[model samples]
Target: MVEESAENVVPPTKGGGKKPKSAAAAAAEPVATSEAGNSPATESKVPPKKEKPPAVEAKPFTEFIQQDYLPALTQALADKGVSDLQLNLERAKIAIKGFETAPECSQVIGRWNGGNRQFNVYFFDDNIQGQRAISCVDLGHRASTLEAFVIDERKVTLDLLVAGVVLRLNSQKWLTRN
Candidate 1:
């Protein structure tokens, strides 16, 4: 086998490869002169970066609560004979007026799986469900405690809402909190 040539090897940069060149640095490159002939420049030529369009700003969590989640959550609760519910827009939450023994007592906007999808999670003892979730059996379910189905935005139907309230009554601290 032929021995590897040291001349052919490129030195590794601190970033493990060619560092990204800024647009300003690329623009500051000297103009090539004809008299310079075929002599190579010290800096390696870097391709100009493509300019990207400004990203559209997305509406905030509270906006989602007011617009999408609140409507669905309100209707779901109302359909299940929950008449005293009120939406707290300032806090981006909802609570029942005359409810005793509130578990899953409040709901706030939350995301799952790196924020790929939007969803609502509940609060236990008025505690926010931030990064916490429960199993799926409580949607009109009785005694299937082993199969825990985490709440997701797509699965929060009227049936699940009723079941979730019931489940929240027996809410256990998340396994992680243990």
Candidate 2:
């Protein structure tokens, strides 16, 4: 077998022979000589005044809410709630006939799998059906009791019954409060 030696290896060069100058260098160089029409420096000396574009008209809040926030909120509410109920995101209202007592409370189940958390909200007719299934792992750094409320269509109200913990969700990023 032939042995490899340092003398046979080619040494790296600072500049490869006869390589063309980079486009950046070409662009940076002067475009014209003294005899030409104008040099870049002279042309740029008295720069043309920039005219500002006309201001765009702002959309009304109601229009914006109807167009954007309403649809998303409506879908989220439907995904969370039970059947036979109508949810209006624009008005921030949920209409359900069976949720009158504690046992019939809406349940928002959440689970944490070390790296991430998954959660789902359900509307229940009875305590057994609506009871949230919270994992022990999720509650490790979280409060024993967790509370959340439906807010103005776009926002959700999440409150920890016990403080000093981190709560995370599959749909959202992890949240922490001291």
Candidate 3:
């Protein structure tokens, strides 16, 4: 009782093909009219299209801010608790008083508690996709300038640029938890 023989039924493509005909596509077809109707059948081949693997090539905002937005914003600010965490990607030629240089730039310097909480994402110009300047120093005061970008109108990832600097340091509580 093997049934399945109207020439082994196979004509359903042309839009109704969102992949739903598998028994491994009827065992990769060719079972025309058998089960002892005395052989002599064959013709139903359609299953051999699986070749898509070549599209991952985006990482150039200064190598995605030194390999994926500084280790995913230092693991999302060490999961919000933040500790020790001294991150740096510096490649400086010095000078960041108010920004405006390019003799070879790069900066990510982030210090921790002992340093009285600090920050400085500045990337003066290595074509870091433009506009980036943040400088914070919590417990030690100094907090006025802040502005960041790595493509916003078009949305670039790495979890939306580390959730826009962890939502501006969790809206200024500077990632609380102290």
Which candidate should be chosen as best, given lDDT against the real structure? 3
Q: Tens-digit lDDT track for model 2 on 1-178?
A: 9986885544555775554555676788866645547676787686779997732212343343345433443344345441232322122112233323334333333333442343334333222112222222233443333334231233211222111112223223343223
* Model 3 Cα lDDT, one tens digit per residue, 123-149: 666545555666676676755665665
Clashing pairs in 1: 135-148, 135-149, 136-149
Q: Clashing residue pairs in candidate 3, if any?
A: none
Worst 10 residues of 1 by lDDT: 137-146
Which of 1 and 2 is ahead in TM-score? 1
Reference-based TM-score, model 3: 0.25
Highest TM-score against the true fold, candidate: 1
Ranked by TM-score, top first = 1, 3, 2
Q: Estimate each model's TM-score.
A: 0.26, 0.21, 0.25
- Candidate 2: segments with Cα more than 4 A from true spot: 1-29, 32-59, 85-178
| Candidate 2 vs candidate 3, TM-score winner | 3
Task: Report how far residue 121 has shifted in candidate 2, in Å.
Answer: 19
Whole-model Cα lDDT per candidate? 0.42, 0.35, 0.66
